[model samples]
Target chain A: NAGVTQTPKFHILKIGQSMTLQCTQDMNHNYMYWYRQDPGMGLKLIYYSVGAGITDKGEVPNGYNVSRSTTEDFPLRLELAAPSQTSVYFCASSDVDRGFPGYTFGSGTRLTVV
Target chain B: AQTVTQSQPEMSVQEAETVTLSCTYDTSESDYYLFWYKQPPSRQMILVIRQEAYKQQNATENRFSVNFQKAAKSFSLKISDSQLGDAAMYFCAYRSAFGPRDTGRRALTFGSGTRLQVQP
Candidate 1:
């Protein structure tokens, strides 16, 4: 079903570089989230959208931005990429109204900032 | 703020044996949910099991089960007949039942995680 798809599975960026991580879901879920996993740590929410046109910052939102213009797409933007931003990013979608049992996560985008 | 804690940073078990990964959470809300997510080398977060705070009965899925202690806010996962595929980093997560309308967001607070190693 292509639950959730994240583009650029792997990337390398130099300092001060900015890039966008694309995420899309065919499930048409209203709830979508972006999370980053640092080494030896659990995933931390970066940003989330309850639905298109409604977005909010999450626990770790610094240096990142997100937009939800359509139900199928939620993209994460990394500005001024720093070594600290070197980590794996995951996009997840869930739907309480659709009776989704739990979240369906994307494979993840592994980014390295050197 | 709600928080999840996984005391065991790492655990290992012999193949075919059983292993338990412990998780405890702190929350003031009575209605909430708990989840166990498995992340192998692939790093894809897979839900292992889930428990509702209001439900007294624990949740189970095949060889995986959770011991839900609502009073203690403790949710531990039990893996039976462990195999090589069972080896992964297990994470405990918490989410509130009510999604605040003001922000329109209900997010999961996850524990650091427990690395599970299955010995052959």
Candidate 2:
């Protein structure tokens, strides 16, 4: 079902440049999240949306923005890329069912700000 | 806020042997969820196992099982008959079970992960 798909598996951006990491899920999940994983570290939530048009900042939301225009898509935008933003970004989705809270994760996008 | 900790930064297990990865968490909420994820070279997060806080029986999936201690706030993943394919970075994550009242609190809080090396 292509549970969750992230675009541009790898990319390199110059300092001050901007780009968007795209994420889509066919599972019709109501909750979507964006996380970044630094070297030898676990994933840190950057932003999350409970549903379309509802977004909120997460643990590490600085230097980034997100928009959930549709239920199937949640895109993360880096307005001014910095070397500190170099990390593996992941998109995940899950339903609101009380029975299970597990997430379906994408393959991750590796970004390097030069 | 909740936090998960993986004390072991790395671990090694000989093929066909068993290995356990330790994870501890801090949370004030009684109802929550715990998970172990495996990330291989491909960098795809795969759910290895999951345990609900209220479930007394330890969650087991094939050769993978979890030792969940509610009182101790510990969740360890044990891999039996370890194989080369099992070598990867393992992460422990936590999520509070707050219902619709707490909409955005459902995000999983992850630990710093333990890299598992399956030695041949």
Candidate 3:
């Protein structure tokens, strides 16, 4: 099974551009999250959803947005992408009701903005 | 809010030897979970080991294990029989057991991370 799938493994954008990072999971998890990892740093939560139609801001949510329209998909949107937004983005999901083991993270999307 | 810290930025271990990466966290909640994740060059975040705050016994998976000191809020990962394949960046993460209804958010808080290099 494709646990968590993130599209556009690599991408480059210019300032003021916009893009969406896709994330899909087949595990039927209720909780999904978006995180950005800068070089030499750990991952920072950007946005998350406990279930469909319920999204919330995370630690770093200024330049990004997220929507969970269905159980299997949670996409991250970058609006007016700036150079400071350049970082590797990761998508993760977990089922909290099932005695949550750990998050299943996607391979991640490496993005660069100039 | 919980915060995790990994003091060691880099570490090395000889092949087949053992190495431990330290992680400390600050949290007011007593019921929480700790985890260690390995991210190789592929950037795949793989769960190494996990420990529930209530569980006094450490968690182990094959060659990976964790020393969870609940009172100290310290969780360290120990890799036994280290191999070249074990070379990767390791991260420590914390998650509160409090349901989203109580905390409004249940996402994990992660530490900076420690890069481990297995030497031959």
Per-candidate clashes come to 0, 0, 0
Tell the DockQ for candidate 2: 0.87
Native-vs-model 3 lDDT? 0.92
For candidate 2, the TM-score is 0.98
* Cα RMSD (angstroms) for every candidate in the order listed: 1.5, 0.8, 1.2
Which CAPRI tier for candidate 1? medium
lDDT per residue, candidate 1, A2-70, as tens digits? 699999999999999999999999998888999999988988999999899989989999999999999
Chain A superposition TM-score, candidate 3: 0.96
Q: Which residue pairs in candidate 1 have backbone atoms (N, alpha carbon, C) closer than 3 angstroms, thus clashing? A: none
Tens-digit lDDT track for model 2 on A10-42?
999999999999999999999999999999999
Worst ten-residue run, lDDT, model 3 chain B?
Answer: B98-107
- For every model shown, what is its TM-score relative to the native structure? 0.96, 0.98, 0.97
Worst 10 residues of 1 chain A by lDDT: A93-102
User: Candidate 2 vs candidate 3: which has greater TM-score?
Assistant: 2
Candidate 1 per-residue lDDT, tens place, B42-82, comes to 98899988888888998999999999988888999999999
lDDT of 3 by residue, A1-114 (tens): 759999999999999999999999999988899999999999999999988999998999999989999999999999999999999999999875536556899999999999
Model 1, residue A45: displacement in angstroms?
0.6
What is the per-residue lDDT of model 3 for residues B2-105, given as tens digits with 9 covering 90 to 100?
A: 89999999999999999999999998888888989999999999988888998899999999888898888899999999999999999999988876365345
